[model samples]
Target: MRRKVMRTLAEARPDGLDPVPGGVRAPGRRRGSGWVAMVAVAVVVAAVVTVPRLWMDGRETTATAAGTLDVAAEAARRQVPLPEGNYWSVTTLISAEESAGRYRVTVTSKTERFLPRDPAGFQLLAMTGLHTRPLTAKDAAAWRAAGSPRLCGDDTDCENDVSPVGRHRYTAMPSLWPLDDSGLTLPLSRLVELPVEPAALRERLLALWPAYQERMKDWPPAPKGAALPTRDTWLWSLSLDLLATPVSGGTRAALYQMLEDLPGVRGLGRVTDAGGRPGAAIAMGGEQLVVSEETGQVLARQDAAASGRVVNAVLFQGAKWVGKLPRLPKGCPKVPVRDTDCVG
Candidate 1:
């Protein structure tokens, strides 16, 4: 009777199930096969998602290492070459934003071999209209024949003085746009190779300062109760200490310290480039100090609130030295001021 009952159960199979010849599988066991397949699909999906994140992380690491290596190489390549005792005429444009309209100032400097015989040694011959038209050849010739004096007769020779003919021309007109007031100009000779200490550089500057001062002794002084001429003579002396200070990693901490050490300077800050290379900014007599980050040079500087404004802007270029200085040609006369000795 038991055998007959088992045969009857086997003959009546469940839905979607086929009886095996010698084995039996429960319905739950078939469902478990589906679960296993789902698990495999989930694992494959997780692996696909994780692989991209790991690849991106590795790429970012590689990029970071490459950037660091590039920066190091650039720093190493930027070796300061000893400057040849050559001459450079520099013109800088300075503009500042104040409550009043923009103030624009142009400063022109002639830096030649500090020859005793050359009257243009380390001097600013002109500080006037920078954007004005350059002098015509005929007019320049006349201006040179007239001894290249400050004024050709009564007319102010702005062209000849700012844009002098022959060897005294500038190599490029460096613009001080978005004026930072703390910019400085330094001679290439002032930059020393790295690994040299700031103290040593300071000594060299001090040793050379006496001569520099002596050379500038004869420069016309700013008149009492008048604006000081922010020319090379004055600007050079003001930034000499900063220029002399050695820098590490393009940041001149020692120079900033020296500037703060000055009598009137109250505070100092560091200027940095886009890449975080450090520089210096000084506060003097209640004004913001801005310096050029590219060359570690100073450009134009000004005093802050309740104090008078001083601006110096210039541009520089290089040219072949023409024989004999050019003369000023006839042109418009400078606007005269009564009881005031200031010449444009």
Candidate 2:
């Protein structure tokens, strides 16, 4: 789903407008040359959420029963040493919930992106695996009681099959780096150049609003005349997106500090991410980010509905600069060119 990042630029825009859409596209990029996007689903049930044990220097320190964790300090302690490599590789597990007749199912996917250091070098994407299952055990039981009918019977066969569960893999085409969007854009190489100071980063991000607003007018499906969001909303959304990016640990810390200063940003106590990792949840402008209490890494970002149901989430698994791209598994579908659309 990372490819959907470019499909809609209104990510986390206020007023409950669905920010990200389906599928990401790069200008002049060929079809199936997977692009990354920023949308997934979060299953955050507060009642079952528990305060996590604090970790210090790789040791268990104390249990924070209060459920409150110092986000900025933890972020500052994050030690993501930039690896010596020729490509920036990012991996994420994305999940989203969709209605299936009377029941809802959660679809999850694992994606890896390899952006070459040289701008002209080919960028690779791989959807390592995907799975769709009932949103909860209750839903599964209900589906079974209903005889496990395929929701899209005779249509597309409902992702995998209609029953227990299954995982699917797909091959992706290679693409070029430096996203070609009409609005604000940041090339892979520029990620390291981001300001590490909170104030300066705020100023830097604010400078892009005019261009972003101008471009939104041309974004397809936008009404002839529609009001754009305020600077606060835009900044909040951008910060969220950038946090999930391969920004430096220092920059990520600065972002956490910036979010702390932003209005309406508040702690949501402890919450578990889609990956079952406990994190300190923070909320701002109708969106939530679950951050690691120890490493300060962004564990997940959630968009919830009015009823407090997490509709979508994007979970950060790991990211680093690598010396080379991952090799395609044996028996992958190969195209005529260098890249292959091989499913693993």
Candidate 3:
């Protein structure tokens, strides 16, 4: 799942990171989220549709460049209705604080069981430059039946049986997209108490961009007249920075209001996720965000798949002030890595 092209972005690391290759960046330095790519594909059958990008160019602003709060405040004042559609939502954030509030964020994404065989599937396999023979229908069926092959091993004919003629479809795996700070766990503290005033909050957030630029090695320089590269990028960076930050509820509301003011961001009307959860969606770029109207908490963030379904979906189902951070259970699944964030 390719991210819909957007103008520019300020980068921020997830909580608790040390500057290092493959590590979340330190504070005052731009960083990446730890979760590079997130994914979950189902075997269910469905009609295919072309993916749609729901974004447009928006004026870029600096964190210090104050924005009108009325737009964001309006969003907070009115709960948006959502569309009715089946979709999948996943837990993306779970932060507990000692003597503070625990916050959880969910993301919503889309995926397909399979891609087209001839060009699509074959092209994907060929990208690896490994498979020699052309995949056949039998191989494809077997691959699909086997829940899609995962490279056959010795004593197993999975590779030989389905390697020819592209057995299963290929997916961009939007859910698994990478970010530098995805694994960082934020401390239950705020660097500074966030300001409730929209303009003041914007200025404070903007001040963090210089550090972000210092850390960004290859990202294109931001647009002219813009303190940060792009509005979307800056907001994204801010979101990651604030996800588990021990900020006041007023601060969070201000952030949301600021986000609502961004150009191109608008209500998603009404929509259901693959998980059959109903949410009011906000769309921008190649992503659709489902948020809770009542609490104004972000519920899910999903990417659009090539097949026109949601991908890279995650749900922040929980975000509450807590007394202490929760403890991770032993043997936590390390599918992606060894980190405090992984639940399974």
Residues 1-117, model 3: lDDT tens digits: 343322111123234445566665455331111111110011011101112232334433233212333333345445332221121112232111000001111211222211111
lDDT tens digits by residue: candidate 2, 221-324: 64575445657766776676576456777788788778767765666777887678998877653366788877877787775554445656767877777887
How many steric overlaps are in each model, in order? 35, 14, 84
Worst 10 residues of 1 by lDDT: 49-58
* Superior by TM-score: candidate 1 or candidate 3: 3
Ranking by TM-score: 2, 3, 1
Q: What is each predicted model's overall lDDT from 0 to 1?
A: 0.30, 0.55, 0.36
Could you give me the TM-score of model 3 versus the true structure? 0.44
| Evaluation by TM-score, superior candidate among 2 and 3 | 2
Tens digits of per-residue lDDT, candidate 1, 1-344, equal: 11112223433546456466536765433322222222222222221111000100111111111121222223423535333333323323322111100111122223221111122222222322223211345544543554433321111233333323232322111221101122323333334342233355445445544554555557687578544323322332344323322234333434433444444444334443212334444543333444444443443343333322322111112222122322222331221112212222
RMSD of every candidate to native, in Å, equals: 34.3, 11.8, 18.0
Q: Candidate order by lDDT, highest to lowest?
A: 2, 3, 1
